[model samples]
Target: MAVIAPAGDRITDVAGITVGHHHRIDATARVADPESPGAGWATGTTVIRIDAPSAVCAVDVRGGGPGTRETDLLDPSNTVQTAHALVLTGGSAYGLAAADGVMAGLEALGVGLPMDDQGHVVPIVPAAVIFDLPVGSWDRRPDAGFGRRALAAATVDVAVGSVGAGAGARAGALKGGIGTAGTRIADGPAAGVQVGAVMVANPVGSVIDPATGLPWAATALDLDTYGLTPPDAGDVARLGDLVAKQTVLNTTIGVVATDAALDPSSTRRVAMAGHDGLARAIVPAHSPLDGDTIFAVATGTVHPPQPDTVPPGMNRDVGLLAEVCRVAANVVQRAIVGAVLAAEPVAGIPTYGDVLASAIR
Candidate 1:
């Protein structure tokens, strides 16, 4: 039997989490002249804010060329075990500056670690960026201001695709953007725990199957999430052309949030498992050219299910941790598909919908 997600099917389904996007769509010009001032300014930033001032967080970086900020602090051995915000943005290495803006915003709200006797606070905002420079105005990428605007616009109602950090994203030969999905553990030891993920899809690989004009993650798609139609003969035929045009500069970054109470080490494992979703959706993922990363955050709202017994060498929490990890991977896969499906064509790149429509036409 297929497992269906609860209504909303979004990362916000996890309590106390809100998402916001800030992107520039005005620059639609192709990346013909890389030296132009606004040649690739079609990028933006996405902010994931945790209402909890100090949400326990962990990160897993699988790609070889990741561009990130403050990730070292997320290490299990680091003194700070929590973060106030997570930023995902486009503009390659330059986009890491956006996290500084997020930190400034959090500081204004008095949300962060207390630092001095004078009531100073330092917001723990970790961030990651994708290389969308080749697709849009590379000269005009995201900056600190973009992060500030995204944080200001944070809300439970998220806007997916061609927005925020996904604005300039590209997946193989198709357009890529923001996508989110969530599910509740229904019948496991972790039942009632909510698991969710939000991703900025700009992989250096294809999310579609060449054999059919459909997403590789189609089996996990929910009702009407990306439409139920399968690719026609023509769509399948275009796959060869699309595959031939594949390039190498890209990355996919995201966060997996859950209501289950998990320690930092357990959360790190969840973050690692979350990458399975990326592998399921994108072909040839985590390549040396891609900077794929996933962060796991636990709001500590729901307690893990208690195991009946604990063996001498094993811990009782392992069962519940396994269930959370499983759900985390599933939601990540769903979110990646949602990102591709929700995407809109920009800078001459065709979206999944555009490809399907062209195929049927």
Candidate 2:
């Protein structure tokens, strides 16, 4: 029996993992907040592409108010399926339109599912957005150009923080909104599987340190101090008040993937696995106003073991995936926190660093 090969962060399960971003408008031009008034007003898009074998995919969304397009295609029941692109942007629901440009890019390459008589190339593009209500001055929206640019720049080596949709974004009381990512490996389902996570943090709540109430090691004094903080149980009473505000300081969108040889159903299981990663990392996640969506992809270029193929020395591998999931979730959670702190203050948004300092090891 052949042993499954292992792929770390730099190498495959998902090889050629690339990311790209496009800034359509400056912050002063468009804003999500009117009352506080952000420093920069603008629009932008973040595109994450995973070049895989066949066009098989799966997803799990746990959001009361989600703004997405082409999500229905991920259903195992759907026949016309083939996803090549995922768009993450800043215009809240308006950002869904950014998929148009990506559609054009994919269509040009003859990607996507088969079309009917009308030549309607059904491109599978799943997207999520962050509320920019705090940067309330400019007209905020995502356009086809933004989508096209994001797709055009897609690559395997992607950067994190204060870029793309994260531009002019906010979190907590500090400058917010941005993308962050991480990867890990395990033994069984985890062995030979390289798990990676990428996310954009934009939440409608305050950020505090998990270790300490002040946010970060001791109290953070930086304008961008950001750490980990789960919502206090006592604050549940004020839930109604928090939801009523509906501001730009809200939500974080993310995708987690592995180079595992799994089908849509299996991938769905893995995607759903991310909920734990979210729960462990984010405070008050999956809220009514937040759209926390995770996408799982399998780049079949690297073949691995099947789920049924249980053998010796495999239990350790399973532990690896479990650990990978934990690390991946924690990394994404920090990414959300970093997104808030790394951003240059827009309008009058507080930053993660301003609210809490980073305790990332």
Candidate 3:
């Protein structure tokens, strides 16, 4: 079969996947008083749903400080290798409550494993959170309601930037937000495999190149997803000044999905490779203060190549798996860039566009 890219370049491009967001942006809080802290509410929750209730899943966590739930169950040796849903949110550890809401929502929809002779089912949902309390009102963090809302709103047309889990996110000195990207394997043994990524970018490192005012992943930009422009010398100089103000508390969390068939071990490898994409896009990434985590899911839509049928050098199954990993990393890098570019300024945090406008002026 020939590889055909999806019309939507976002993570929803992957078949059997849907994304949703629920956030609160307080008007008064938007206008923060430098003298007074925690004035606004700019945090929210994002949920990624797989059509298959038991899709194969794995997680890779590389940050020094990670706030996650049910990650241990994802281990290959664990009893449950499948996941029903995944949650990403802002609010530090407090945001974890949102997962409870997701569980309830899924339960209501009759999704999850059968508990016993009774009709009770338990949904396996893993969750992760980024520290956005510094930018938004700590009092108004994500809760069960936020998770339910996000799940209820799940759709193929995902909204990116300054929303969902990325609402209170900041990338170094610039605003951070939600972003997604996807691609189809055009050729080779992995032809027709569809891979995509959704990221809530709130990193402690820089996503832009100080020397060019462009995303470090500029080479991977597709269709000018962020409306990028070449930076002038002045813009470059300004970026240098901004990097000097790095902070120590932040995280970049996300999920990657593929239509290709993969077991739990393969999914774990893909998740690890996804971090490579993060490193490529963000300078000084996976820092002690950043809880950078990536989750991988395979819907098993397309079967891997048979080892016995393919050429020896090809190692078809292994080669295709590697290709999926490569695409997963690139998509992640692009997603991070998309988050920064599409973000709207909030809570006095400047966006990439705001910085661009200032530098050009």
Candidate 4:
């Protein structure tokens, strides 16, 4: 059986994986119809770099309006089975440019697929973006420079909430931001395996239920875990107007990683399960207006039970791989909830905690 690890709440708990963030948050600036350079900048970029020897990778895109780059190559049938880095950012499709900087950085470190005996190499960096044009100056999206800066800042210490790709994110009418969670197998055939997830929550749907003014995931969890509580029913009922004004420009993009050894196919399955967790945390997920995507990376530091060890004629459903998928779903759900809880008010948008406060007042 697997147990949640208490320490290292972020995805960096997965060995060999490091996260970095670069964003610009302007609380007092006004959004200009005309493009502005430094002022009114609320968008940023995040980079997840896989360490030496690369790692198996795959992705699953569920939202109708996903903004991604090089996702097609992640298909199991494709030639590339690993990725050097993954980028998540704001600015809709324009944010995809952030990956170019990560690619350049990795190439500088001599990481990527070798093209020849010469020092030439192409880093496989897949990226996804959330539409956040209305949150800041329309043209102040992330560029290659943002990506490079994020990569340079990569470390095991991850900063959550209103940072990186989530600087301008919104969950319904409430502020959304980056969140992460992790788990480790304590005792079982899967012992020592670690699973973790990090998410930029900007979904079109609400993470809070207006009826209770608590995160939807709170139904099965203790609100105290997120420093939250149930608001007075009368107060919650009074906030009807805010609940109706859901943000339309949104997408929840994230990555799930594990230290367990897995192939591209298995990693893709884990990615799919991450979406299930998304649905569990957010109401009406994977909508046409949202570009929800999840990518999975395996560092292959721990070996799972080999299929050959299973008895013949027995179903393969019950195994270490299955346990990993289950944990991935759980961690993804926790990460999304954490994102909403950690988020701070930005661009005039409130956070779940803000709503709870209003309900109490």
TM-scores of all predicted structures: 0.93, 0.75, 0.91, 0.91
How many residue pairs clash (N, CA or C atoms closer than 3 angstroms) in each of the candidate models, in the order given? Answer: 5, 62, 1, 0
Q: Give each model's whole-structure lDDT.
A: 0.83, 0.59, 0.85, 0.83
* TM-score rank order: 1, 3, 4, 2
TM-score for candidate 3: 0.91
Clashing pairs in model 4?
none
lDDT of 2 by residue, 118-162 (tens): 655666778877765345444555678889999998766555455
Q: Sort by lDDT, best first: what order?
A: 3, 1, 4, 2
Candidate 1, residues 1-361, lDDT tens digits: the string is 1122235688888888999888887645575433453354588999999886436999999998999988998998888899888999998999898988898898888888899878799988999999988765557888889999999999888788788998888888788888889888887679898899999999988888877777774663343565656767786777668778666658989999998888889989999999998898888889998899999998888885587786868756787889999989988987887787778878777777776774322
Task: For each candidate in turn, give its C-alpha RMSD to the true structure in angstroms.
Answer: 3.7, 7.9, 4.3, 4.3
**Backbone clashes in model 3, listed as residue pairs:** 29-40
Highest-scoring model, lDDT: 3
lDDT of 4 by residue, 24-132 (tens): 8876644333344234888899999888474899999999999999899999999999998999999899888888899989899988999999989999999999988
2 versus 4: better TM-score goes to: 4
Q: lDDT for model 2, on a 0 to 1 scale?
A: 0.59
- Give the Å shift of residue 3 in candidate 4: 25
Candidate 3 whole-model C-alpha lDDT, 0 to 1: 0.85
Rate residue 175 of model 3 by lDDT: 88
How good is model 2 by TM-score?
A: 0.75
